[model samples]
Target: MALTSIKTSGDKIEIVNQLLLPHTTEFIEIDTIEQAHDAIKSMKIRGAPAIASLAALTVASHLSRALQADPAPEWLSSPQLLDPYITAQLDFLYTARPTAVNLGAATRRLKHTLRTGVEQGKDASAIAQDLIQEGREIDAEDVSRNKRMSKWGGEWLIEQVKAKGKSPESLNVMTVCNTGSLATSGYGTALGLITYLHETRKLSRAFFTQSTPYHQGSRLTALELLTLKIPATMLCDSMVGSLFQHNDIHAVVVGADRIARNGDTANKVGTYNAAVLASRHNIPFIVVAPVSTVDLDIADGTAIPIEQRPALEARLVRGAVYPFTLNAQGVKEQATVMVTPEDLEGVYNPSFDVTPAELISAIVTEKGVAVKADGASGFDLSSIV
Candidate 1:
């Protein structure tokens, strides 16, 4: 069965608590705007596209419940009040995670919907209805876009291998972090391309890095591939270099939280290390993300913001016991243990790192695939964006 990050039934919205993933599956509800904001900020729900979808859908659900309230909210009394209230809510959600451009894009799109309805002189309720539909659309559109970009990336890799006089069949591809259904509205970005190759029988194995500190790759991506019955191998973050030296890796693919206009990508923190290693190995490094992940306002990676995680996060690890005992509820019992000394200091833990465009062989989006021009150091991105 496929893993889902968020589940919505009618007006209800629930997301899987990714922090306790692999060992356990837990669902948490988001009924209020504050709950959605906390979910994104607290890292209970993540991935650039997934968080954005949750933020948008939560707004839709909030408005839906308000429209059916015994006494309509005062904000619904007029377009003026409703507009500001919803705008404030969107703005708050955007602040939950500043690094992921998709969250900002989702908020901006809803803001646009609100502006269009208000300009048409629609009533407060009418404008609220418009916002609801737009929010739902934002979440609904992610899956199709993911599939399109995955296909574009998967086929492009095959062509690249074939051009080098090598067979595309049984190609081995590597990825970092958890870019799968659990990381997005549905399907995925980088992992989606690996899934595409698997479905088409062109893949021999799927390789993923353990993604240090958070272990999204080990805890989340490993579970995703297992559930899908995809053949996969896990390597510690530092093993990437050794893996490339010992194996015939065709490419290293990853999902982007943000991509500057020149194609520099900000993704999982260890992504840059993987990109640098891929370059040394002469392996193609591809980034697969939706067009929304592209930030036209940012000219390069230096301008992109990098989120720093709590220092304690890097010192501890969470997992089930060695014997893997299950509680009365048949759920695995998990615990967090410190890997370093209690008073350890000077631990650096940034949530993401930027890979310069020169290291990126191609940037795949729903629109198409983008590659740097001959002898060029950066990508134009005009055609893909």
Candidate 2:
């Protein structure tokens, strides 16, 4: 069976506890806007698209509960009160993760729906219903668009190889971090492209980096590939340069947390390293993302805020203990072991790194594939976004 990051049944929303993933499958229900915000902030649920879906759905569920209350909530009594309450909740959710722009986009979309409904002279109940519908739409739209971008990116990579006088069949691709369904509402961004190739019988094998610190690649991506029965190999982050030196990696595809107008991308921290190595090896470096990830407000990557993780997160590692210890619940017992000395000072752990547009060969979205001009260093994404 395929894995999903978030699951919904009617108005109830639940997310897998990613911290104990691969070894344990635990789903935590999100009952309110506060629960959604806390899930994003605590890294219990992540990925740009997944984060946006959870927030939007939580809002819908919150309002749904309010509508069924014995006495309608004060906020639901009037559009005037509903506006501030919903706006404040959306703002709080946006602040939970500052770097990924998708959450901001989702919140803004809900706010827009609320504003438009009110301006149309709709009653409080009607406006709330409109917001609820918009929120559900936000989550429902993710899967279709993800599949679209995946095909665009996957086909583009094939053509780029053909132009180089190489057979496009059975190409080897490298990716970093976790970009599969576990990271998104459905399909994926970068990993989805890899899946596209696999489904089309154009993939040789998928190579992934361990993505140190969080180890999303080793833990999450590895599990997803294994579950799908896709042939894959796991390598350490530092070994990317060495892998390029020896292996025939045709492309390095990555997903973005934020993409500046110039096509400068901020993604998982180790992505820049892979891009640089790909450049040295003459491998194509492609970025696969949705149009919403493009922040037209920002002219360059420098303007994109990079989130810094807690120092303790970098100092510790989590996994099921070796020698096969199983708890009474019949699941492998997981533990967090400290990899460094207690209270280690100066642990530099930025969750993401920005890769310049010059290093990117192509940026694929649902709209189309974008590449730099003949002599251009950056992308004119205005056309694509």
Tell me the whole-model lDDT of each prediction, alpha carbons only.
0.95, 0.93
Clashes of 2: 0
lDDT string for model 2 (168-203, tens) is 898999999999899898889999999999999999
Displacement of residue 71 (Cα, Å) in model 2 is 0.6
Top of the candidates by lDDT: 1
**Quality of model 1 by C-alpha lDDT:** 0.95
- Determine the backbone clash count of candidate 1: 0
TM-score of 2: 0.99
TM-score of each candidate structure, all chains considered together:
0.99, 0.99
Tell me which residue pairs clash in candidate 2. none
Model 1, range 194-283, lDDT digits (tens) per residue?
999999999999999999889999999999999988999999999999999999999999999999999999999999999999999999
Clashing residue pairs in candidate 1 (N, C-alpha, C atoms within 3 angstroms)? none
